[model samples]
Target: MISWDKDFKIYNFKSKYGPWALVAGASEGLGAAYAEALAKRGLDLILIARRQEKLDELSKKLINEYSIAIKCLALDLSDIAHVIEVLSQIDLPIGLLIYNAAYAPIGDFDTIPSDDLAKVVDVNIKAPLLLAKFVSKKMIENKRGGIVLMSSLAGSQGSPKLVTYAASKAFNAILAEGLWSELKEHGVDVIASIAGAIVTPGYQQAQNAKKAPGTLTPDQVAEKTLKALGKKPTIIPGFTNKLARFFMGRLIPRKWAISIMKQNTESLS
Candidate 1:
């Protein structure tokens, strides 16, 4: 993993008129890094996460460093009614939307509870679908916007251990690709970003004793993801991950692919 550097931007995206961006799961990880990057580019922000304290802390830090306007929303996306209320309330002309919140239950499918699976589905799949519909309607009326749906490399294959999570992410990956084809002609850039394992609070909390040699950092993922925004509709954040995806896509049989994913995720956790 590369060290985080404050001065690593290839090109800045300073908005001329304080256009806005919305980042879900903005308290930490790739979401937090994306928030900072957009703030540096002078985009006003609407940050959403389940934790109020983390949101406030991040809001203060961003405002102090970037001097941009910020609004914080503390809501669980799994709570469908609350999510609907929150989206309906956001009045800003959002130029970009980053759907970055997700969760996964770690275990064999039979052992995992239905409630746990449902929660992962709700955030990983439902929230993005609803948020995208809301944002796209507004952007369509205004004639421009962009969206980046956060997916996972595991989504490309099935996993016996993380069954629901993998399926949900797979849904997200394809959903964004379909949206890109539909929205690009409408002056909207819709992208799906398949992120590799990154060093984040959540990852650290769940990390195995034997950590991998080439895990990426959240900032590194964010940097590449931002650069890939309008140019590529489907982006795999790391060179290693991209190459792995390509090689695996060609050589692995479907049943073996699923077994490998299950073994790796369970062993690595």
Candidate 2:
């Protein structure tokens, strides 16, 4: 069990980081949960996603419930230039940035279209790189801030069907770790959240199943992530996930790890 102080107050967040946060992929699932959690912590938000209606609805709900400021940008992360432009216009200093947008294309490497592969790289890797560059500059200038990059267990090893997706997440994880080392001296905290399976709409759609064993709820993942921010360079959300990663990365041979991962992912397919 991953335990934290149940009585830990949200004020600690506001005091350490600033009063505003930016959350990408905020329409649903873990992104939405992050937005809600930040609101409860008394931070205004800038929400980005592809769905306009969903963004509007979420903005209204959070504003009504939390009474905090919110700006919704219904933009696709795949559009790199437009995403940069939109972010450039945010007048508020973003104290925290959660790069949660990702695309996972599951299939044989050759069976997947080239365009689909490019799109995954664009959203999962390029967008985060650009956004982090933009936000960390401001955070560095301010002399204090936080960033959370949403990575996955898939990033740790070869995933047969989720090749490009896993590779992209590996990029995210390594990027965040590098930034953490560089930024910590400047008073900015960076964390790569190595998540396991979570019960989100996106997960359901990707797996074409109702639920996966050992999966966590989106809220559980978000809350835990928020609590752990700025405390570590990387975090694996669940105890089971932590154990699995340790054994797979250390205890077994590289060939055996890849083979086991292939078997597990093939079962999902």
Candidate 3:
């Protein structure tokens, strides 16, 4: 079991998030960024994703670069039961859980198929919810650990084209808030990273226009998120994101906020 200093300062990374860390959706993009960041901190990794080849490729690179032990699980997060079963079989001391996988189906909500909608719920909401439930038990037992759930600023309001996705992300933000309150006394740190537009390959493929305001690199978001983990319940990764959240979530009225979000998302979806 790791000890918390009570003063809430993160004196060491491995003490809290190692000797092992697990990154879901870790094949690329933000997930891969988190994996690299944690590996630099001397944490052996258990990386999860649906593509075995990609996982193995990333695993090889990280092992060569960082010389840290790595375990790759090519399991789909949508299969929550199987994901949990595989994780449970791992004997490593995985004290850090980074849930970054999301299924985003963009378009008019009515135009999207029902199966895709269900997938959105399964991947974005169900997986993390269950993973948190499964992992937090061990964290509380050990009396120290961390959970970083990836949310989005788009979740701050009713984003028209991103309706279901936004709702699911909102769920993550609220879930982390509640978990932070409940787990802090147990020495478990929980944080929600409410990120903005990221300059990721996937985002680039989906983006039809110029870069959005407050667009951030995957590394920037990952680094800022890790830095904020033990200190706050939630963090908006960019200055623009923080300001946007302040205005949309607090200053502006709900209808106006929703309209702004609609305008922003309509073009992309």
Candidate 4:
């Protein structure tokens, strides 16, 4: 585990962002990593995911380790209404919102089932967008809070085999960019972590090949992204991913970049 860098970011997290945080998709992998990082920083957490057992286990572990209050809920993020209903019932004033859940269907766009694509839209696009809408107003009222939307480096441009997933991620980054500007003046921090590959359990299940270059651990990405929260609209965690974004976004033709992505994501197909 990468230890927190006090020298790098010294925000009085509890004071500036309130006492409580809510992490959607908090059952495992990157989502669980985000929950851990925040828990270590002394924030009480409201953990949400689809698995009740996993949420219960995680809540027990975190409460044991950090001695912080926790509330765990099992619900599908795709059902935005149920999620909102649950959120409303929580008496705690959640000051930090982390939307880490995403549905990524990896294959040629046309070959993939329409229902899978629709699931992607509901989970990846609708959930985060609406959660941000619901949470940000309270942040604006409190005059300080944060929102972190997980995106991907693949979302920077059109990735062939990952078309639907990439497109959905692109929606998140753009949403965060717009909200960062609109919400910053209200003292609410917003950032999109346009991350590269991470060695999470979900990633391992999906990937058939060896670890990709510059693959980071979930903790590393979580730590770096949280550190960068109030500082930028978006962060690509790894240096390799940052370099990739620079070349793809600034140093090449659009067609050339897309072609590069085709080769890069061919394995995913």
Candidate 5:
């Protein structure tokens, strides 16, 4: 396990949230952490995940602990058409919408099939963008709300073994920035977060198999993300990851920068 110092600017929310917050991928990982943090801020929740049982269990804990309203939506985001269908069913005035679900497969292009590529694009790129489009309209009509998209550090540069994953994140990063520019004037905030490696179940399993790095914890990432929502359109969630972005931004040559990324990915296995 790798341990590093974390920097946090924990701001207290002075006013309680009105209506509800919808969190996709709320059954586990950083998404679950965000759900808990928002609940603590007095926002009622609408939790979405593929696992109904897990969503129900988490909803119970949030309601029992925070005494806030909790709603659960079990969704498989892979079905693009059904996402819109699912959201139309919710009647609550959603004050916050967070699209946090994602999937990734690690390997070279030849080894990773076209079907896998489409799946990643569907979840990491298409789903979040569609969700943003739908929710932005709702927030627009309401005239006040916040929407956050979960992006990743892989987005900042090319990821060789995870080529499509990096491209999908880049799409999200740009989409969030563009939306933030457009929506802020309308009294709605659109924020995208680039999360670093975190101590979630997926990361833990990757660690056990010597695959992914053990970086920041989910709570640690969540704390930074919450602080960044209103102030900036885009945020990188850990100290090292922030520094990485800063240096990556300064790279003069795109070819050289992507070359470094390719080397890093080759070293992973």
Candidate 6:
């Protein structure tokens, strides 16, 4: 177990890396929480999301309150070419990258449209892969940086209703673990933030329900995630989530885990 220092200053992210951090999916939910947390830590930001209005409002709020440079990029993650073009034009060196955008299509795998599944792959897998590849190069040169990929508990099991989404998150988790091993030598930190049910707008919309008993707030997850950077290859946000992942991934049989997941997600059917 990694011992976390209670007084560790998260603002040290600027000292270890650089001045700027780029956050994908920064319009709302955990993305917006990350933006707020990072801003509080004194880092300039480049926020990207599909909604221009939301991004603009967030950027203004951060800029006014924190007195830090904020750039809002409203673009679809599925548009690889446009994303690449916009990122390529940025003059600042981005030392921290948070790939938080994801596509979760609920319901049976066969019932969901093929195009929707493909979009999930593109956003959750391809976008992160490309962004990491692009950012790691600059990080390797500087010999200091951090990357956080948003993963899910579903990723570790065969979630029936969220099959494609689970698979994509698994890919992200593995990628982060491998990169953490490989990049540590170069003074770069890679983390897979394995999150459970969080009280976010997206989650509420997707589940069509209010926050459950054990669900975490976005701020809570964001704070914990930032604190865990450079400390572990993977960090499960809440203690309850951590325990659940441990039991589901280790103690329980794989078939049993899948059965439990299927039952839990039956509402999505």
- Give model 5 RMSD, 1 decimal: 5.5
Q: What would the C-alpha RMSD of candidate 2 be, to one decimal place?
A: 3.1
Candidate 1 TM-score, true structure as reference:
0.91
lDDT by residue for model 1 over 84-164, one digit each (tens)? Answer: 676677677777889999898777788888899889978888889988998888777766778989888888888667778
RMSD to the hidden true structure, all candidates: 4.0, 3.1, 3.9, 2.6, 5.5, 3.6
Query: Distance from true position, residue 111, model 4, in Å?
Result: 1.7
- How do all the candidates rank in terms of lDDT, highest first? 3, 4, 6, 2, 1, 5
lDDT per residue, candidate 5, 1-269, as tens digits? Answer: 43232211211241312468888889998889989988877788888889999999888898999899998888888786796786787667777888888887888888988899999988888888887777778778867778889888777878888888888888988999998999888778878898767777765554233434426878888777777777899988767777777776674567666777776566543
List the pairs of residues colliding in candidate 6.
none
Indicate the residue-level lDDT of 13 in model 5: 40
> Can you tell me which runs of candidate 5 are displaced by over 4 Å?
1-17, 207-214, 267-269
Candidate number of the best lDDT: 3
CA lDDT, every prediction? 0.81, 0.89, 0.91, 0.90, 0.78, 0.89
lDDT of 6 by residue, 101-176 (tens): 9999898887999999999999999999999998899999999999999999989999998999999999999999
Runs of candidate 3 with Cα error greater than 4 angstroms are 1-11, 207-209
Model 4 ranges off by over 4 Å = 1-11
Measured by TM-score, how close is model 5 to the native structure?
0.87
- Of candidate 5, the 10-residue stretch with the lowest lDDT total is 5-14
Model 2 earns a TM-score of 0.94
